[model samples]
Target: MLMMPLEIFATVATGLGAGLALIIAIGAQNALVLRQGIRGEHVGLVVLVCMLSDIVLIAAGIFGIGAVITAAPAVVVVIRLAGAAFLIGYAVLAAKRAVHPGTLHASTQTGTMSRKAALITVLTLTWLNPHVYLDTVLLLGTLANQHGELRWWFGAGAALGSVVWFSALGFGAKLLRPVFAKPGAWRVLDGLIAAVMLFLGIKMALGV
Candidate 1:
């Protein structure tokens, strides 16, 4: 009566697919990760935080936590709006740096945020945002709920999948830092980040 294996594989696929979809994007989280990676910051700590946050949410979902989250519609709306606003704000910051490339500095020298602070910032931005719950918790959890006996395995699979993707991204960015150091490379990257955030913010605002 319990289809655990199917659930696990399905969940794993969902996790991997979602991770791949968003990992390479120029969103705030990825930008922070890449910045740290290039500066040779506390990458291990960042990866751990990223993965743990995901696991917590996924675990919460399997335990019916999403039902509670979904029940609070007003809270969801507020969080979504706040997240979108933050993204837009970050986008502006990125665009400003892009046009004024001289303002950009070594991430290591930027005393604005230390490695621990940076990692926490990414974790909060990622986990506290409503979109994360909607994608990983509610959607993926609901999928797992369908399997009578396989739901547990599905949840495990999804969790493992998330771990794999984020770990890779966290470590993989270091390899790209050199290529990104070419003149105007950061400008292009910042511009792309700005564009993506603007697009996502507008889409969320429009209820799209």
Candidate 2:
């Protein structure tokens, strides 16, 4: 009977490790989240959206929806186009900010974004990335199925990994606020963001 608990723990650990492995990478989503975190703008909302999106995708994968997604090539193409366009547009905005960076003091929050805009941006960064679906729904789903009857537990662990990572990422970024207190810091940060978005957008559009 004691072995049963050990088995469950092992399964959960496997899921947690796999999920973190896939997510803990540098990408457009992570960059956006880090920017928002540094600004202290809707950090909770951004983290919630990211975590919930992962849960839904992971659950879909475990429930056998991954196969459906893999079979639909056209759906991927459409999403790729849409995501690319959004990324390019966002890149332009970032570039503009870098060029004309007005008051961006971290203390007074001179450039606070509206909650609605923040939510929309977060959702786009989370859902519009085709990689999210592939990683969470297809890859993670296949991995969880290896756990047999404990697959749900595996999924739960994967979900928990997302929760832990994003919570830390979004909240932990506050430490950088002091560094971004200067307008030049904002300019440099936005410049980097623009470069990433532009590169990813072009890559996506070219189907690379």
Candidate 3:
């Protein structure tokens, strides 16, 4: 039989590959990241939360927490409800912004309150949603376990892939700052975000 070390490494690779594949798709998560990039506010903070959340969840999936979460069904329900509320509220805000996105402010200035708010929002949005656990813990976790000893390696690969994907997205958005500089960019972005949120919210509520 193969050693655990070799199996773990391979497992991590599998996890990374799976994560990167799922993450690259357009979804609420990606939309938020892009919107933040367009707004040019707390870019690093947002990106860090996004990446760290992935790492932690993927770890949970690969390691012991997957089993723990699986045993607790109500926990998932709570997350889904909370996430639904957030999404609904977010959708309203986006729609409102679509009508009136406010004045264009210089991206250079960072108010203290906005900074704190950005950090909190990103953390909550990343960690609080049931989908995060479902995707990372449930799906990825079960997938990792199937690899036997290689599961750890699959998770390691998945986490690293997350780092790579988020870095690319964060930097890529930065590169497009000029394109986002247009006056109506925020309104359009917010509108799109709202639509995405609503769609995601409905999906969650209906258990799709």
Candidate 4:
């Protein structure tokens, strides 16, 4: 009995590590979450959306839905096109901000989006993107299925990773508010985000 628990724990740990490895990378979702965290605007709601979305996707992936989705090339193509457009548009905005970062303290107030708008933005960033589907659904699903009977536990562990990661990312960004209070810092951050988003957008557009 003790060995069973230990085995499950090990499986969970593996899932957690894999999940974090995929999620911790630079992406539009992470960038938006960090921005909300720094602004302290509806951070909870954003985190909730992100965490819940990952959980749902991971669950779907583990249940074999990912395989079905992967089999449908048209669906991926449609999502890829739509997501690429959105990413490029957002990249342009980020680039604008990078060029004119404005006062960091005032940046939050310059044109603070409504909670509803932010929610929509985050949802798009998370769901409309094909890369997210490929990562969480296809890759993670394949990995979980390798566990056989223990796949659900692995999915649960991945969900836990999402929870832990978003929590840390959303809340932890506040710790950097002091540093971001400087206009130069905001400029640098937004510039980096712009570059990352642009690269991702173009890559997705090219289907590379």
Clashing pairs in 4: none
Model 2: lDDT to the true structure:
0.88
- Tell me the deviation in Å of residue 87 in model 3: 0.9
Instruction: Give me candidate 4's TM-score against the actual structure.
Output: 0.94
User: For residue 140, what is the lDDT in candidate 4?
Assistant: 93
**Tens digit of lDDT per residue, candidate 2, span 35-84?**
88998889999999999999999999999888998999889888888999
Model 3 CA lDDT for position 129? 76
What is the C-alpha local distance difference test score of each model?
Answer: 0.70, 0.88, 0.75, 0.89
Error of 3 at 136 (Å): 0.5
Better-scoring candidate (lDDT), 3 or 4: 4
Task: Write one digit per residue (lDDT tens) for candidate 3, span 62-128.
Answer: 7778678779988888888788777778788778767765533324342222878777777767776
lDDT of 4 by residue, 94-180 (tens): 888888666233345776768999999899889889988899999999999998888888998999999999999999999999887
The true-versus-predicted C-alpha distance at residue 83 of model 1, in Å, is 0.6
| TM-score for each of the candidates | 0.82, 0.94, 0.86, 0.94
**Model 1 lDDT tens row, 93-179:** 878878887676544354345766776678766864677788778876787677546666667667676677667777887888877
